[model samples]
Target chain A: MSALSLHGIRKDYGEARAVDDITLDFPDGQLTALLGPSGCGKTTLLRMIAGLEVPTAGTVTVGGRDITRVPAHKRKFGMVFQSFALFPHLTVRDNVAYALTIAGTARGEAAARADTLLDLVQLTGFGDRRIGQLSGGQKQRVAIARALAQEPEVFLLDEPMSALDAKLREEMQVELRLLQQRLGITTIVVTHDQREAMTMADRIIVMSKGRVEQAGTPQEIYHWPATGFVAGFIGRANFMDGVAQDGRIMVGGVALSLPRPAQFLTGSAVQLVCRPEGIRLGAGLAEVNSIEGRVTFVRDLGPVRDIYLETRLGRLVAEQSADQSRVLAVGDRVHLSLPPDALRLYPGLPVTLPATALAAE
Target chain B: MTVAAQIGPMAEVPPALRWGAVVNLLLWAIALLLCLVPFGLVLLISFGHKVEGAGWDWAFSSENYLRFFVGANWPAETTSLYLGQLYWSMRYAVVAAVLAVVTALPFTYLMTRQSRRAQARWLVFLLATLSLSEVFIVMGWDIILSNNSGLPMLFAASGVTDWLKDTGWFDVLRDWGLANPRNVKFKTSEFATVLTLSYLVWPYAVILLYPALSRLDPSLAEAARTMGARPWTVARTVILPAVRLPLMGTTLLLFVFLLGAYVAITVFADPSQHTTAVSIYENVRGSTLNAPFGAAQSVVLLVAAGAFLVLGQRLSRKSQGGA
Candidate 1:
């Protein structure tokens, strides 16, 4: 059964809708990530589930019970905030034991439980330290320990890794994921970073403009995006506008076939996206959709090389492994391939005219 | 070394350093004259002997201290009159400061939750009331508390006084000295004195607490709420503990400020219940005309204020260290 569910949740502030008609379910013992850019209502949706926000018009259900009217304190959902929000006046042990103490637990029992939780988070022997004395990662661990001390039905985190440095954020993401899996608690994390979401979530929900763009497994989201926005947002993709003619897409008069026939009717405007790594560089034996272009820029990342080319179709970026012996410089001429299986087509008028058409004119 | 390199920045250093030292010395001298000299003169006069007619002359003696502790005719018969005045002074200041802070705490917490524009408006209103002269404030309260016209007359006009008499609560009020022969009177009572003193320092309490309460991390409260803490529990466990030091410090400061209050005490307190501040006025410029004794009282009040300040600092520091 789904542990928590939000149905048609909406939050309207004046004329602006912070969260618009979001309906989602968090499966039990699974971690879900609400991923989006800044101001995309992911945090708002999370807050509504946490009972921190009252929905304008919707019902929230948990385990077959309607808890829409329940306030935050009554819900007892453990949440780790972006700032951690540890009480500076309390020692680490007291901070972890706060929920237990407030719930009328005995001091000895609460302290024992706090110690166990601190051990769970690998923060042993640091119980007597002040909150201000902890490092950023240590503070985050204490927050997690405090939240888990309640053994809440649902755990929520809002940008929990944003305050940590890049290196520590990645490590904590993996560590948090392991801890959540071991406990098998229903958890939801709100994050703007796609990599973090992919690393930690069992399922990822992509949101934009206060609406859910797509929700699926990370691989499915990466391999098959339901919208042009989702495709561009989830990963780096080179977009090209074309018109569907017969069973092929015509891009600057070069007809490129898709793995499956175009879904849109002939003569309808369509957008095509291909991942950079899917595009092969240099001449191949078969040249079905090959384009001649000059290299305008070469970015040599340690593991991969991104080759920027001004092609007849458009300005396309192609990626190659750094281990490959092909060394290309700026102003070098090259032929790029757009494989049929790697292309994704969506029906929409192009937002900007493709550079190929501008060159053709 | 090269001439340009040697003289480039070093040549300008000596004159600037000399000018800075001169300005620093001048500021220290002025500070000493303006801040310390008057206090020194007060201390010096505190030990001087009071002359016979109207003035006092410089002489090292402990007569003023002796008179403060006991009666003027010590060793023969003792009187705790001045000591009683000192006690009333501390009692009134303590009660009024505590009442003001307790009341202002809720107001300040609520005010800080408002928008900046609304907070600014509240500050303006509070400052306007805070700047009102003590004499004017005392007069205003006097009109409200007087037996002939204010609350007592209003109670009579509204039949509440008769109601109290019927309920036999009037006897209790009379026993407490809050009522006269026929009607309930508030003037010249401890109730009226402390009330007016609390009102006088209430705005100051709000202003002093504004910064600490406003800077409090609201997320801390919400975090507690999510941990299954009720609103009251969150306040007790999170908000109160966080602002504990500020509350104590604000109370101490308001107490010290109320120590020197003159008009409120003189107008509302009975003559026998008046504080050391009123006694200082009587000795300095009133009928007594004894300046040295007044200086001695002023020094005592200053010392009391300083003691409370140091106590507050130690308490805050201890709390911080314990945390």
Candidate 2:
């Protein structure tokens, strides 16, 4: 029942706005990721929510209580920092008991509780071991156990999987998500890795330049991207610039049609978005709204092959399942189908990208 | 040495060329020799015997050892006076060194929490004061506690002497020998000697403990704070236990350094309350003019210092191994 909310939050460091006016919320018992490229204010927003950083102008409410000025210690929100931050001097048992002992619990009782929590995190016999003795994954698990020792109202993790290797990262991702789901703790994770965000979060908040560009389930953000930036950031998308005319957009000699007139002013320039996964290779230009191009490169990624095609409109990369009957190699001529329904259009500017195209791309 | 061409292959090198690795090796060798020769001489001379009048004889003997332990009048005269001075020397060094490290721990922790620029500036300031000669520090305290220009003077000038006289607290100062008939005085007092000794090593204590305390992960303390510790509790639980080893090691090194102190003790201590270093000075180059006796005392102090250093190192190794 304790949901965390932020409204019109802004954090400025001198002349630069690290987190420009951004408003968002995390419903109780749900995991939301603040995803973006580095320096895009994702971590800044998460730190603000944790009360570690004070926002220049905004209100942060947790369970309907204003915590805008509340210090981090009083918030009691368990946090796992990127480095794990386990106390090097303490044994595993003492680190886990840190919360209970500090809160005036009896020594024996605190030790017992620490053991239970360690057991929960699967670090049961590691009590007497020093933090430095543990592997990267084990240390992160201890960090998680230490954070939960206080039974914090909300959980916060900042790039928790980044320190591990690729295989370990994947395993911990599933383990952590399952742990979060089992506890039903309201959690927020800050990460720039889209795959990581997609793996753990129930809803992903895609952010750019200190603003929430789009917020939705990972599936929604991936399939029905609200902006070109979302499409490019959440996954890969091939973009082509053109001008909208009636319900169709002309790109060089090829005229790409849309299901309806893109919501834009008449005669406005636009950019069209088509995902590589949806584009079919070796389909004749006449078969669908399509383009004719020469293959520039081919990437075989085990199960699928990415065919890079160069056209007068520009270069586009399309993914074809490796088992597909037709095979395209680098420098081979191929036709790519750009169906009208799959193509999302947005207005474009001469310099900056069109706002609508940001969602579609 | 200045003309490379004149010195053969070592010479045909450029003017700066003699700065070859060979020269670096020679430079290092000379550096080690410069530092070690005098101490080596002291070790050799500790075995030599004293002659009549002014000079000493060079002969291997255990007389110096026997003299140091039981005294010159020992099996026959029965004097433990010099050995007793050595005992007080160790005692005072232990207490003052421990006191300095205990106080420096918190101050160093606070200093490291400051920004890097601030830390550099502080290092400069502390190093400046730390490298200052001990003679100067004793002189400054000489003024402050001289009864005419310092704390006691201000106390009397402000009627604190009269107030203490009325409150009967002045009796405690008198009983402790911290006062004369009219007012409180720190001259020729243990309090003044210990204070100066602690101050002499206080900066050193901070410098010695700096790297360990500075590199301490801030996140660890923050993690403890988030776990519901108050500021004091965080320091007690996280900071203190974390720096305990360095704290003990710093104390031991400072104690070894303080064991050889002479100026502070001479300036502030009564003649009857003299330390072993003063006695060593007398035997080596002062009135006694007995170099062998002085070398024996040097060996004693060296042994004490070395033993403590080894103990500290062993303790550090033990802690590291356990970790």
Candidate 3:
């Protein structure tokens, strides 16, 4: 029943606004990720929810009860910091038992609960180890166990896997997600890595410049970005800036038709984005929305090959599956088509085009 | 076979190693001559006998040590006069050192939380204060604690003394020996002695504690708070435990530094409550002219300080192990 919700949360640091007015709802028993680049206010938003930072103007409610003015210690919302902030003086057992012990739980009962949690995190027999004796991954596991010892209604993690290596990070992401679902505790994770968000989040909130640009399920956001910024940030998107005309976008004298006409008035600046995998290159493709292109470079990524092309519209990259029979090398001529359904159009010119696109022009 | 071949080139010492050895030898020589030599001379002089109305002579005797523990005329009359001075010395140093550390800790913790620029400014100000000689600081306090021109006068002029009398707290102050019939007094009192001693070591305690406290992760406290501990609990459970070693270390250093403090005690403390340091000064260079007794007193003080330091080290180690 502890569904956390924020209304009009804003934070200002003297003359600068670190977090803008924004409202969001985190449903019960769901995991949401606040995904953004550095300085995107995602961490600030998480801290505000944890009651560590007071919002300039907002109400933070849990299960319809406003806890806006409550201090962090009284909120009962457990948070894991980016640095894993484990107390060096305490052993792993003492660390995990801290919340219960502080609340006057008997020593034996707290120790038993800590043992169970250590086993849950697969860190059994590590209770006696000092913090300095553990590796980075082990320390993060201890931090997670300690945070969950309170059985908080809302569990917050700020870049929980950031200190881990690539392989370990991926493994821990799945492990953490499974644990969260089993516990069915409402959770919110703040991370800058897009893959990390996509891997573990039930819903992803993409933020930029202190404002949420879009919030939806990962698939919805990835396949249908709401803005040019979201499209560029979420996944690899080949962007082409153009002017909207009668039912089409004109880019470098080429009219690329959309599945449906854009809602913008004619002569308005617009940007079209297509995923690299959406660009079809072959001998026979529909003439409409197709352009003749020359392969400029080839990149092999073990599972897929990326082919860079110079087209009349601009420079573009196309992803080719490894199993594809035909292989395109540099200087090869091909016809690439932008499927009308795959091209997402947004009003306004892109702030900056790709360097390759600029060079091609 | 390869290991053997590799070890062949390492059999001979390189020129750099040779030069480093020479420098190490030179440093040891300097340390022996500068530190150990004087310490050996002090120990040697402690056992020597004093000549009548003259300087000390080089002859082994335990008479000075006996005189310190008992009296100069042991068979007929015995008094623990020097032992009492030693007790006062220990009492003042221990109390003053603990007081300084207890107060400096919170101030240092707050300073560390300030911005880097502010912290730097505060550190510079503390270091600047360190340049004030002990004599100057004692003189300043002497004036502030004097009855005619200082706090006693201020208390009389501001009517706080009369207010205390009205509230009957002035009788309590008189019972504590803090006031006379007229107004509050501080001169030649234990209160003034400890206050000035604590003040003299307060800056040193802050400086010694700054590095450990500034490096303490603020997140430790925040983490404790998130775990449902209140601010006071966080300070007790987390912050204090994290800096326990440094706190003990700082206290011990200030204790040793205060053991020999002469100027503050001489100015603020009553003549009957003077420390072993003052006794040593009187015996050696003041009117008594008994250098052997002075050297014996110095040795006793040094031994006491060493024993306490070792005990403190052991306690800190045990606490660390327990943690």
Best model number under DockQ: 3
Candidate 1, residue A162: lDDT? 97
Question: Residues A54-117, candidate 2, lDDT per residue (tens digit)?
Answer: 9999899998899999887788999898988888878888888888887889999988988998
User: Pairing residues by index, what is the TM-score of model 1?
Assistant: 0.93
For model 2 chain A, where is the 10-residue window of minimal lDDT?
A351-360
How well is each residue in A1-361 modelled by candidate 3, as lDDT tens digits? 5499999999998888989989999989999999987999999999888888899998999999999989999989888988899999999999999999999999999999999999999999999899999998899999999999999989999999999999999999999999999999999999988889999999999998899999999999999999888888877878888998997899989999988888878999998998888999898899989999999999888789888999988889888998888888999999999999999998875644244322221
Order by TM-score, highest first: 3, 1, 2
CA lDDT of A360 in candidate 2? 29
Per-residue alpha-carbon lDDT of model 1 for B1-323, expressed as tens digits? 99888777645557889999999999999999999999999999999988888499998888888888887899898999988998899999999999999999989999999999999999999999977989989989999999997999999999999999999999999998999889999988999999999999999999999999999988899899899988889889899889999899889988988988899998889999999999999998898988888888889888877887898899889978877
TM-score of each: 0.93, 0.85, 0.95
> After superposition, which runs of candidate 2 have C-alpha atoms over 4 Å from their true positions?
A244-250, A253-255, A267-269, A284-289, A345-361, B1-37, B47-52, B58-72, B75-80, B155-184, B314-323
Worst 10 residues of 3 chain A by lDDT: A352-361
On residues A231-283, what C-alpha lDDT tens digit does candidate 1 reach at each position? Answer: 77777788888899998999888899888788779999999888888888876
Better of 1 and 3 by TM-score: 3
Estimate the overall C-alpha local distance difference test score of candidate 1. 0.90
| DockQ computed for model 3 against the true two-chain complex using alpha carbons | 0.77
Residue A96, model 1, lDDT:
98
* Backbone clash numbers for all candidates listed: 0, 12, 0
After superposition, the stretches of candidate 1 with alpha carbons farther than 4 Å from their true spots are: A265-267, A349-361, B1-13, B159-176
